[model samples]
Target chain A: MLSELDLSAIYLTLKLASLTTLTLLIISPPLAWWLARSKLFFRPFIESLVALPLVLPPTVLGFYLLLSFSPDSYFGAFWIQLTGSGLAFSFAGLLIASVIYSLPFVVQPLQSAFVNLDKNYLEVASTLGFSPIKTFYKVVFPMTLPSFIIAGALGFAHTIGEFGVVLMIGGNIPGETQVLSITLFDHVETLQYEQAHLLSISLLIFSMSLLILIYGVLQKRQKRLNDA
Target chain B: MPNNMLKFTLCKAGLFNFAAEINLAGVCGVFGDSGAGKTSLVRALIGLDEQFIGSVNFNNNVWQDDKHFVKTEHRQIGMVFQEPRLFPHLDALGNLTLAHNKRSLYTIETLAKLLDFENLLDKKTIALSGGQKQRIAIARAILTAPQLLIMDEPLSSLDAHSRALLLPFIKRLAKQIPILYITHSMQELFYLANNMLLINDGKIEAVGDPQKLFIDPRLSLVKHAHSGLLLNVTCLSWDETHAMLQGKVDGQAIYLAMDKPVEQEILQIKVESKDVIIATQQFPHSSLQNCFTSEVEQIEQISASHILLTLNLGKQKLLAKITAKSLQQLQLKVGQSVYSYIKAVSIIGEIT
Candidate 1:
């Protein structure tokens, strides 16, 4: 049987992942659309900046985030003034770190989908007397629904398994910032081999199951579209 | 008259620089060769290409000018593209519903029945054939209740049977609203266009009646093998004994071989220049059943071996292709009366 600490870690991980995924869904669409369609000279520069977390080490990102979230930094000072609390080692700060870490996972799929969309659909919708916003909702959104699902699942799953950024900024605070990965790490470090084995196996099964479920749903949807 | 006219003076700089200024009314057929900038002109007129300079004024409403531009949705113009661009995610009915505005000209049921596609509404768009998809696309455009309908080679991708089936529908729609139809086929031009615009190398070559423009020696259409004229004929009665359709052109009786009875009062028959046989005098004893006494209005040498003759059949004109040797042998001259014999089997009546 798992201890109360392990169960709490699982609950906190789910909560953090859900919130991050929701925030990303709200913000990433416009950003991805712009990246896909804009012709500005500095577009490539912005694209590279968005993709930085994909190649850079997570601890390197965590180190910078830790510095920025400290009480002395300008961002941390502003956040403290607004919320009446320090940002370092806090749930709010941990969420910010996880979002940055999982951004590329959510945004790349959406950008490619937007890029490859058939332009005739937009033109036809316009000729049919639909406004630009209405066209996006009616034509673009439905055509790219599969990409959205993939992006959400990837963002959620990636956030759930995060360890380096959470540890550097969240500081393993039980029932607060401490998540499944960090809990497993703590168990192994304390030489509690039995608990560590149980935690590792459970996480392995859970991640595999999530991925399989998402891919299965996507395949079924593709078949339905083709058959219908 | 200006209030109901479509006038535009547009210019664009690209691989092929395009420039045109014209005031058009009725169903204007835009004819050109491939790469003549027909699609580009349509894009500019419909506000799809923002780089075009100059202006477009449709029915006294300024669609585009130096400072202001109306978006495509607000221009109140319905367009049918070369290909059927239906939404695959929506069924046929759903696609139509998206374009059903408060001012729709016809209800969905009426439109489906009129277009003969009532069976297609519940089917997914991906499963529909090319012709079926195009029907739904046409229905969607009309459902918007636009002021002007623009069809850009809507039948170019369709098969002959589909083309035949859809022509009458388009003709019926033209009676309600002015249409700007783009096409490369002269048959479609003769069947649909009351006014014609000829484009070559991205410039307006001429604009006038299609029947007259088709025979103009300076235009490119005259150089084609199938260049011909359209004659307006009224069905008089069916000759049941001879199994032929009796019709009249310019008060002269004409006969046509048809497998079906005449369903319409007025019909247009295509007469290829090559199919016309010129005789110096009428021969009373011959197998040719239809003959007309026409006066030679003009004669122009088209090639080293061939000459094209324009004959006056009262108010209508007929073109005859003849060899230069025959012209010299017969000593044919302008203002001379000649007998023009057209075979009954060669004339096919086009239902209007």
Candidate 2:
């Protein structure tokens, strides 16, 4: 009865979600902090560019990444001469596209969180004898942890549901880039209704659970603040 | 105790350009209005803003000078802000230990008990009251074992009733570290300050004892009035035989037949200038019992109906408000000595 299960899609979806969440975690902090605290002339300009992914079509972004890394392109030619392999239609290329597609999901919440933080914390941190870097790590980072967690969870869930960008850049490489959403579409096109239903139910349940986790943690923090 | 000499200019308009030389051991209060540069003065002292000119030298170590600069962390100064700004992520114990420098004075449990943080250690900062948060912030600063402690209107955030509770902790803090408390309230200054710097226009207008100089309200009112000092009275015993009150004004004790009773341990009479009767020669059977021999310190007209007489009875200052017509008739001069008599009923307040 359970023979219609897509084991490969399940594995690929988990890998993509985990890798995308991990990479965004590393990339979002400094970018979010810069957007939150920087007073540079290029700050607003850079901020608008980071937010461009939010408004731009994911297919368009995926198409550009696919072209840029194709074997016939300059980036591909350069990579061929150096590493000797183009990233087009590869899992790595798909991951890069996924990062760009989910950029604002990971960053906007964190930037807002940093903005909401007490500015006096940093001032008092310096006065209390912590260096600038030490203050950021010891004070700013710890205070913004809840935001980071929520951002990571959202990015992970977003990447898990990704279909358009993965199809464009990944090209449905079985066991490699064919994530869950793409496989569910493939099952439907092939008249495999049972297979589609199984993958769809799993994706729905997984996304719901991740969202509930984020809400639960955020609510707990709010309750503690109210009680205090 | 060596005085910490610090000079700094504030290009910022609202703050002051204070050049204060003060002792660092006792509680040093920078008293002024909100925009009078109280916080700016403390911020400059602690090296939060090094852009200003001049230097700060504490115990021969210079924190800031024209050619060199030291950051706040390295300055060894502890700061407690008005809002407490407790680290919300950390519990009370963690908040207290955030700035511990691992010096000999490092005692987390001791401070927790002293600050009443025992029951609240496991509780999150969001669970604490406004006053409790401030206490934690103060404990965090103390844990650092800073050389100088700076408090910028720490009490200003609390309610009037809450301030009464915290005043004792601040008063007791004088025994531990030198505090620079910034405040605009005259009541806060009167009770809290031991040594004060009267900050006005971002400059040190006056620096001296809190009780001695706060005289006039507009300028020196704080210097004089806020002191609320003791006026030694003689012969406070009730006279049962004469069925009257007995007290002395200048030196000798006298009897009064006034109906009202002075119901407190101490009495302060606001010697209005009009009520006083000056006698050329010592009047022998006068109805006024409170008579004193005093020399005039200054004769200045305050209003059309009121002239202030600054009389000196020994070391005590006697301010009497009289009418302009009375001054013209008496021909009062600055140096002229005279015997002035006062009725016992004019005294306004009595304190136990």
TM-score winner among the candidates?
1
Per residue, candidate 1 scores C-alpha lDDT tens digits across B152-177 of 99988775556766787787778777
Highest-DockQ candidate: 1
Estimate candidate 1's alpha-carbon lDDT, on a 0 to 1 scale: 0.85
Query: Among all windows of ten consecutive residues in candidate 1 chain A, which has the lowest summed lDDT?
Result: A124-133
Model 2 residue B71 lDDT score = 82
For model 2 chain A, give the 10-residue run with minimal summed lDDT: A1-10
Native contacts conserved, per model:
0.75, 0.90
Please give the lDDT score at residue A226 for candidate 1. 88
The per-model DockQ list reads 0.73, 0.64
What docking class should model 1 receive?
A: medium
lDDT of 2 by residue, A65-158 (tens): 8888877898877877887666887777778888888889999999999999988888888877888788988898888878888899989988
lDDT of 2 by residue, B1-352 (tens): 5445444443444444667677755576778766777777777778766556677777677777777788888888888887888887788777766777787264878767666667887778877888778877887888888777788888777654445545656667766777777877655565567778888777878876664445443464433443233233443866666667777655655555545565444343444444566654788786676777888876666667776676677654556667788788888887888887775344333211
